[model samples]
Target: MINGISIYEILTLTTILFFIGVYGFFTRKNLITILMSIELILNASAINFVIINTYLYPENLQGAIFSVFIIAVAAAETALAVAIIINLYKMITSVEVKGTELMKY
Candidate 1:
């Protein structure tokens, strides 16, 4: 174990979580599920960023600040996306991935 936590262990865990998010994003057809997957991916990224920052610059707190901002933005995005999805569902009676594609035009 390095630094009381093996580097390999941390990397492996992060990789697994990232791939799980990717799989969810690709396999899930519902808009909400896709949103959740996106959130998962964002979380994984934040985790990796924090770990790297802590390892490389233990004295600086910039990474924590950035992570907080990321969380705020992700929360806002999820709120807005959920509202839009609800509206779309009300109009189409469904929240499937392709159901809202017509809104593009």
Candidate 2:
């Protein structure tokens, strides 16, 4: 437990967040929503990494380092995904996943 918050509680929160992201990914038809869901999933994992590392090996920085890397990658991914979604919107006038099929030859 860290600061009176049990690791199980934190892990449970991460699990819920991850499942919400999964549910959103499956149910949302909009590309932007899908991207946001992906971000949520990434964030949950990053949080899990940091929390577990802090609890299991307080002296080691590997968990925190990996979490930072995950955040950086997620930022780049969001930027690239947003750019793609914008271009797709311009071409199809919609950001729905079904609209992307029109781009295929």
lDDT of 2 by residue, 17-72 (tens): 99999999999999989999999999999999999998888888999999999999
Flag clash pairs in model 1.
none
Top model by lDDT, which number?
2
Displacement of the residue 86 alpha carbon in candidate 1, Å = 0.5
Residue 17 error, candidate 2, Å: 0.6
Q: What is the lDDT of residue 19 in candidate 2?
A: 98
Query: Across residues 24-87, which tens digit of lDDT does each residue of candidate 1 receive?
Result: 9999989999999999888887777677667767788888788888899999999999999999
Instruction: Give stretches of model 2 more than 4 Å off.
Output: 103-105
**What's model 1's overall lDDT?**
0.84
lDDT of 2 at 102: 48
TM value for model 1: 0.83
Full-model lDDT, candidate 2:
0.92
